[model samples]
Target: MDKVNNFELGIIGCGNMAKAILSGIFSSGFLKPHQVTAYDVNPETAAATEYEFNIRMAGDLTNLTLNTAKLLVSVKPKDVGAVTDSIKNVFAPGKNTIISIAAGVPAGFYEKKLNAKAPVIRVMPNTPVLVNKGIAVISKGKYADKEDLEFAVKVFAGLGEYVIVDEKLQNAATAISGSGPAYFFLIFKLLVEAACDLGIKIEDANKLVLDTMEGSAEMLKKFNSDAGHLIKMVASPGGTTEAALDIFMKKQLDKIIKAAVNGAFNRAEKIQDKILHGD
Candidate 1:
């Protein structure tokens, strides 16, 4: 093992996704404790993240890549400029691969900010990444070589599944995966609340929702059955399940959910345009 094939990983921000990657990289033995370094604007957050992961912590972003690095930029969209500004003057071109997990920020922003033809890989990952079950969609900027893009995909695969996507479809990716977790969580909450209304204890309600969801997901995985077929499998004709299905259909559930997702997609586009062009 080229112990450093994992690379001397550097993280520019210690937010949730950053921490999740830190935990995944360390736990998976892809990198040793001394092989990773991180820097965050908040001194306390930087210290806490470092302490938890047992990695080196830099006091500033400029110092983050002092060693040979494969940097992951996990900062917020608005704060990317500041983070990039702090390190742009110091970052080495072609020697490092930069991965950005900020939603709605285009690769062009990074290219202009870095002021160098640095290999930049843009990724959109969901919140489930924290649990090591994330779906990440990635795309390469013009600066990224084939090897750089492959290594970037490998890093994300260490955390979860990854899809090679086109930059133009990023807004759809943001809506489908980045915000999809919240949508599923909302459905889970509603299911649990309904169970509780039927006199199930809160704890039992939670277990029921979790078990049912997990079982359904597992069945889908094994059977390769479409959702409609899966629903039919559970709901016998003219039974209790059919009664509930009737309500869901009467309420236009599918149409409503489609509208909800599209709304999210449109809002993501608006934010990107607003930030990039102030439209």
Candidate 2:
């Protein structure tokens, strides 16, 4: 029998997230295309991915598990059970490590479906991973140890930033980092619209907002201070920025944002409950 750690990395789905991860892995020179294998239920998607990435495609879930020591389960949360069931037999105890990126799916869920000793890691990765700028939060299961978690982190580091969190906090991480990009994008859209409403041309508004956002992000990256501190720095006592900020404070923007974040957090928790209990 092949040693569990001797096999290549395998991905069990070829969706957008899978593609993004593979792209980052290959681009980062972390793994060669041939070192990775992928399987997808959709034949067309598999074939397209094979053609685009020049990586081998597995004939089935079993084939993927047989060839890879580390498996990344990228299917939707609803399909996790079926996918796990199909490949569970191939998973060797204390050998293979399972990493799941399905939203709201817990590591325990996979461990329960597979062998109790199976190592599972749960990850919450955002859409920015498509562009190699994603933030992924990872958590370990009952059997997974520091080594297993580190291996999962290495794989995701190719895509972008990653943080290790307790399994209990995975849902909160999903709400923040996993769903964070959409919130930023929505805010950017509103900012663009507001700019247009203020007499700026649509194209120019988009450019202005995008550039400003990019620069602002860079500032955050360069500075060691927190966002609140940075905002205070920008909004001088009686400046135009302060004027807008004053209105935002009066309107209780912070409360609104907290509520929005809590809404996402609550929804993530509910989804996890539904997946776990079929509620």
Alpha carbon lDDT of each predicted model? 0.82, 0.87
Against the true structure, what is every candidate's RMSD?
Answer: 2.7, 1.7
Error of 1 at 239 (Å): 1.9
TM-score of candidate 2 to 2 decimals: 0.95
Model 1 regions lying over 4 Å from their true place = 1-7
For 46-165, candidate 2 gives per-residue lDDT tens digits of 999999999889898887887788899999878889998898888886768889999998876777788878888888888888888888998888888888888788888988899988
The true-versus-predicted C-alpha distance at residue 128 of model 2, in Å, is 0.8
Model 2 shows how many backbone clashes? 0
Task: Please write out the lDDT profile of model 1 over residues 1-279, one tens digit for every residue.
Answer: 343233377888898889888777767777787877888889889889878888888766766765646789898888877877787778776667688888888777777777557778889988888899999999998888888787677677778888999888989989898899898899899999999999999999999999988999899988886888888888999899999989999999989989998999999999888766755
User: Which 10 successive residues of model 1 have the least lDDT summed?
Assistant: 1-10
In terms of lDDT, the best-performing candidate is: 2
